[model samples]
Target: MKRIKFLYLVIGLTIFLGCSKEEITSIGQQGDYITNFDFPTIEIFAPAKVGLTNRSKNADKFLWEFSGAKTITPQGDTISYSQSEKMVPDSAFYELPGEYNVKLTTWKDGEQKEITKKIVVEKQQPVIVVPENIGVFLEVTFAARVFQFPGRPVSYEWDFGPAGTSTAANPKVTFTTEGPQLVKLTVNDGDETLSTEVVIIVQGELAKTIYFTDAFTRRIYKYKLTTQSESQVEWIGATTGYNAFGLSVKGNKLYLSETGFGTRFSAGDAAIADGVLKSYNLDGSGENIITKPVAASLDYRDDPWMHTVDRFGNIWWTCRNWGVRVINASSSEAAYPAIKFNINATIAGEGVSTYFASDIKEVGNEIWVSYAGTTGKGIYKYGYDGNYIGKFTTAIQSHAIRTFVVDQVNSHIYFATNRADAGHGLGIYRADMDGSNIISVDTHWSMNIGSGGYSDQGAAGEYVYITNMDIDVDEDGKGYLYYGYRAISDIYGSGNPPTLGPSAANSGVKRYNLDGSETASFLFKGYAPYGLAIDQVKR
Candidate 1:
């Protein structure tokens, strides 16, 4: 049995040796190209591509083997991967950061040569830190703050508060609600992934508001000071004959003088020629229910241009041609015209019968008046009893004043004249409280002081407002100051001199900065805004 096993093994060895010697002599005769077993040295950063450049010498076919097949694509070389080329390309890129043993086998004439190379992919791990809570407004967008390892050539995904999302690096986002919101940011660089979360505080729209009167459309418009939204004042179409000429607010009550020439004082024309002085609560309750009547009383006619309420609840208003008139107002019964001031009483023996006050406002204990007449036209001061105190324009050219605005903290009185043509006194001026130190502040005047080609000014404030009759209402609602006059395309008919009440696209107020630079224009839309007032109720 031992001799038989030995004989079989000896025969098997003899056969393999004979075949090997035959194959070697045949390959030597055939001039096979498989000679070098070498590869190029490769060094690169992690997660980047690797090149399997063919630099072998005298090779007919090549095979590559990459270990740890899980992290690599086209995992390992197969039996059919022997390509007929000296330089062999890789199947896919390497994505993991670790040393890999790559085996290369070259074949020519069925003779094979093999080599191995150690590829070290260096590591790059970045740290990410998400920010804290960021406050954002629900109506206004907020630019997000982010701090992360930069220059990584990474892709990002952002989940902004619940459902909002963005791909921008520094994204401006508006949240849906007002509260603490959650945000998530995820970053990835090939095989590396990182993410973080933060809270964001979102603010909501405004609740309280500011009001304006549209004299032409017989309505009042309100602007939400906090949210920057504008709409009409309440009790508008609810009550007829609600034309507002000038507006004043005191303790939840909005007072308006809505009288001018050739105007129907109604939403439906049920007025008595001229407009009426009326009041409405902040929520638009109590329209002309128990206040100053819409009729002439105490020998003073019922034509008031603008009105103001004193601390005593008395109404001091401009009575058109009848100077200043005071009315005892109440929420109880219809009030009567109390005191009338046709201050014909001479100052330095000059009777000022042409002294017709066009607008009035109360600052502190005294009431200030802006008038437009042939004589004694300036910002005039008066006591609570309708007695004339002094004239402010006496320090400058005293003529043709229209609106009065008193800034108590600065002791400066701002007023605008009714004339807009050449040589007319400044369309707007500022002066000391005691009728001195007169200085012009308006920057748009001279050729056409007011738009619509008329010579009269309207609402003025820290942002001065100008009333226009149907000027650029449908377009941008803006007008420019050209040659010192507000230049907007005239909306009135040819040869028609402008009037106090205008129709159509209505009016807009241009807000001018203190340096006379124009800031913004808020259109009144459906109404002609003649006068402006602010409600001091804190919200």
Candidate 2:
């Protein structure tokens, strides 16, 4: 009788457990409800209305929560509310620029499921776009950026003080005034008008500027040529990487070269890659690395020593131990061969087969490269396409040309060289365009050539080397040549053969009238100058 009672109790317990499991499964299946929503294509600017579509299944009760949203009543009254009914109101409006959350909570069989979505409304305004620096007598374009709905047509009006006004979307305007000029833009998109104003500084008509770099400081400074004060120098910007050796100006940009991280004798892969060709705007803004050294490229081993931009917008620079390298500033290829030399060639004045190509310049339609190696020590001429044209003169073979500048207006070449023989002093000299009639330009000191502190040996020789020069010609065809004169510091080098004495005062930037007359001695002082350039408009 006890066994029968136990079996009956087990069967009863099984029946109760089975019924409870089935009931729970049915409840969970009913709770599996889906919620979905989507928005239409819209600009979603301020004062916008958004319409949402509901895609839900197996839910009887619904709740909509709009976080601090706004809406318009039946009589066009604006009201703020938080929660809404089962069906969202078509009059829901977002009148301010911000983010809002729209939520949907559904209930089925006492279980709740919710979904939240975000909406972003953008501010309605017009943005003005213009160049950072604008000059007088130069045409500049101004643009206005605005948003319009599908059927709305936007119109723009611009007002440039002293330069007149324009109704075109983007207007090309020129200002004759030199001071601060006010620019205003008004954009209308049928419903509303938004406006913005900005003040643009228009540089003077004859603002001549000179840019030069300091090797010790690794920074560039500019001085207004029109300033009559006592050398008021302004810092433009600082350089990156290592040696800031080369600088040039073309159009509205200044190009600079940093010779990587390590010394020329100790360069590794990192040092080669660190070498860069960079550019900046006239105000020292917008620093851009035009190109950098890469593996197997010409600049990989031979870093950029000196650089110049050609008429075709191609950047041509001389590599320290190799030949010339070129790159289209707009091309994707970084650094490629402009001219490569056969290092095994005989040491004769036949071609440009030198290990040291020092400086480069774009003269007329040709490119001139200077070599300072034991063999080819003069300037070699080449076409823009890298074909050999000829050499400047075999006479210059005796002097190691350090730096030179061509005065197109005066038809003369001013070069600085290191030679104390053949009547050539360790100073600046001038020659005709064909390299004839060479004469001394500046050999002011009696010790410029002989056994004084300016010896042709030791650190003193390097202190007197002119590595940077540029020419600026005015509208009257008169030109001025500017060059850096590094002074021999007391810490230059130890020993008596070469010393830094009172002649160290000869340091700073020296200016000449192109006729060899000293325009200004120590036009700028107190720093060791290296790379130099002038903001002369392209002729």
Candidate 3:
């Protein structure tokens, strides 16, 4: 009975101790609590007094209010809060000039934070300050110089106090007559404006000027020849045209053959059929058409193509269907048949087409005609009586031949042979007036010479000038020959070929010496300037 009582007492004690420990654990778990938490700080990188927007990231909520605003509201990252008293971006574009302060309050998770910043709205207009010293001179054409501060003013206006007109910006203006003139210039940006003036004294004549005339813009500019100042020379309209193919001058008269304007053509016939041959004075005055009113035919196959003029002032030309014709120097309207070669009847079965007549020279009583047929290549001679004086044949098919005064002091007839496919460089040959004792000095293709047979066009020389065709000799007795060389781009184009322009490899007029040395060239303005004539006029 005593043992049983002890067991009961021990068991009771253990149960009581376990109950007390459970109570303590429950109190400790309930004590883990938090209160009065502060919100996280915010750092703003924007300027102070700025028009603020809620740009905070990862925030649950926001309570925003500006310093001077009447009401406060909940704002988020997407919500922007603005105040009428607060300045906005671009609001004072050209008005206000300085910076301001602004404040923002953000609230998230029952916590509130405030931010402060400064902002500045810039004016669009610039500040312009004109320079004080402006240089002046005696002549109205004197250079008008002005300076400006900041160098980037939006607008500038210039007034040259005399009858002279007003211009804008930094400009150079010349006066017509000489005297003291007040020059004024105004500069402005949207925000600021400034003005500057200077007294100018100009002297000297404003007459006699240089000018330039392009094909499209026919405005002739007149620039003072003394100081290279330019002005308007002439105003040409639809009445004035351009002729790229034909240009010749006699005395003070200039003749040009025009082939209509624009690129409208059908089978070589311009819409305004029959091209015009017009004449004008050297000073761009007294313009009139000398050719007959009947539309001048652009018939290269049948009619006469005026190639060049001779020393005697006679216009010598050739017709494909007919023969050669001569125009009197005094009257261009009068044309007479000087000689007609009976090629069709004389050659019979041989295919012949008179491409062009080479240069003509009158030796003694006979006129030498360097004629080349399409099939038979040779130099044909004709007497003053229109009688054929036989021919001298070259090895290759000849297209054209030019005669140069070879040693006029020695009276030797030197002609250059234009063979079609033989080679580059000139086939230099010398013959008598009757075409005898033919000697060939093959130049061979040098770096100075172009390639192939189509290259040899014309040659010119004094005593030492001998090329396939054209040759010009300097005082050193060396010969420079001018030849027509077609490039790969020439045969496939419609307009002017690249080989005929200023950047051509072998275009324009070429110059060489007697021993085939010191070759140079000059770019001719016209396209394919096949005909070249140099004569001394009584300027």
Candidate 1 residue 237 Cα shift, in angstroms, is: 5.1
Which stretch of 10 consecutive residues in model 1 shows the poorest summed lDDT? 4-13
Ranking by TM-score: 2, 1, 3
Computed on alpha carbons, the lDDT of every model, listed in order, comes to: 0.50, 0.66, 0.37
TM-score of 1: 0.49
Question: Which candidate number would show the highest TM-score if scored against the true structure?
Answer: 2
How well does candidate 2 match the true structure in TM-score terms? 0.55
Better of 1 and 3 by TM-score: 1
Q: Which pairs, if any, clash in model 1?
A: 54-87, 220-233, 241-266, 392-435, 445-484
Q: After superposition, how far is residue 533 of candidate 2 from its true place, in Å?
A: 0.6
The count of backbone overlaps in candidate 1 is 5
Please write out the lDDT profile of model 3 over residues 47-82, one tens digit for every residue. Answer: 112223334433333333333222222341222334
lDDT tens digits, residue span 1-539, model 2: 11110010101011234545442111122444876556543446665666666666666666778875776677988788677654333435776657888888877768888899997766667778877567677778888766665587888889997799999987999887778888999888887888999888887544578888864556788877763223367897655554566888888888886665542333355335456788888779988877776666543346677888988888888766656778875544354444444322432354445546667899888888766554456677788767777776546646667678888778888887754535786777888787787887776533333323222322322322566798878656576788876654411332322344443344578888875656445676666666888887521
- Give each model a TM-score: 0.49, 0.55, 0.38
Please name the candidate that would achieve the greatest lDDT relative to the true structure.
2
Residue 418 displacement (Å), model 1: 1.3
